[model samples]
Target: MIKLQHIYKIYEDEHAKHDALNDINLEILEGECVLLRGHSGSGKSTLLSLIAGILKPTKGLLEVDGVSLSKVPDDAATLFRREHIGNIFQKYNLIEDLTVLDNIITPLIPTDLSYSDVLKLADEALEIANISHKKYNLAKKLSGGEQQRCAIARAIVNKPKIILADEPSANLDLNLTMEFIEEMKKLKSHNKTIIIASHDDLLFQSKIFTKIIVLDKGKISDIN
Candidate 1:
């Protein structure tokens, strides 16, 4: 469902140029879960941003679900991301002032769906993420695991086809990490494609991944 060919990303400052990604070539099939493992500055997040159309590649081709993101206009890319890609960032990125349900329903606001339909979707997403009971709580009052689950619920509220997670377990305890991983596994059962950028060894140890890609110094170092 996703493809990147000869992709390159470079950031230029007045003093120097840094290559965030170099000649990346990757393909992820539908219903597949792929893990991207690497240390800091390894281009894992850069690759994810490229795939999600959050960043335009300096060079190369990118296609997600047959739409060529490399050629898409900025507004089109934004629309495509909203409709097709679900993102879980390390910070959870929840709106602090919004209730859990409100935050989860934010993405549905731009759609023409009725208020009842939006609420239904948010409730269903909370159920899938196992956070339905906390629907009315303020986001800041939730625990770390609860907040992470809330992030997942918000991401999948639109039933996006692809889920991109960047260091999702970075701030969690062992138990919460396991819980998050299990929740991700459940997503595969629903035929959603998941791509995770993490250095967590436990994730690599899991046999659920269809493949694992390692990045180093802005390029792919290994694939298995």
Candidate 2:
């Protein structure tokens, strides 16, 4: 339920304009999993940011589940993201001093849910991400895989419809990358629309990915 039409992302400084993405046209259906595969600075992250409403496109239309994101107000886009998007970044964006449960429940803090409800969500998310055993541990004490699992738990705690992961396998070893692939498969089975941006062969090689979109020099090089 994602569509980009003639999309362009241009960053402008005082002296020059650089295009991060140019004339990007794509469609991702509900429940479909796609991989945005490219080297660094090839617009994969920029495209994912556009899809997640973190950055607006400079030209053309972007719609998620029929809502025109490019036209939405800033607050509206934030709300829409809260309601629909789940993100996993390469860096485990967890607070070092916060406990795992606290970190996972951070996203739910803005909602009107009761404390008990928030705890329930955090617990459930931890279970899904296989990080429940670290519930009370400080984030800084966790291992790399544990930290990544915590990030995944936090992202999914909101029960978002679309999952956007940028370079999820970038920091992990082969074994941990395989663990991530398994998690992705589970999410795909749950009918969540998934898109990942990475150059890691572990993710792109998986048969779970319905399609792979390759970007090079700010343009789409191939879609397979």
lDDT of 2 by residue, 2-43 (tens): 999999999999999999999999999999999998788999
TM-scores, all candidates, are 0.97, 0.97
lDDT at 143 for candidate 2? Answer: 95
Candidate 1 lDDT by residue in tens digits, 1-224: 89999999999999999999999998999999999988899899889998898999999999999999999999999999999999999999999999999999988988999999998899889999999999999999999999999999999999999999999988899999899989998899999999999999888887779989999988999998
Using lDDT, give the best candidate's number.
1
Regions more than 4 Å wrong, model 2: none
Tell me how far candidate 2 lies from the true structure as C-alpha RMSD in angstroms.
1.1
Worst 10 residues of 2 by lDDT: 198-207
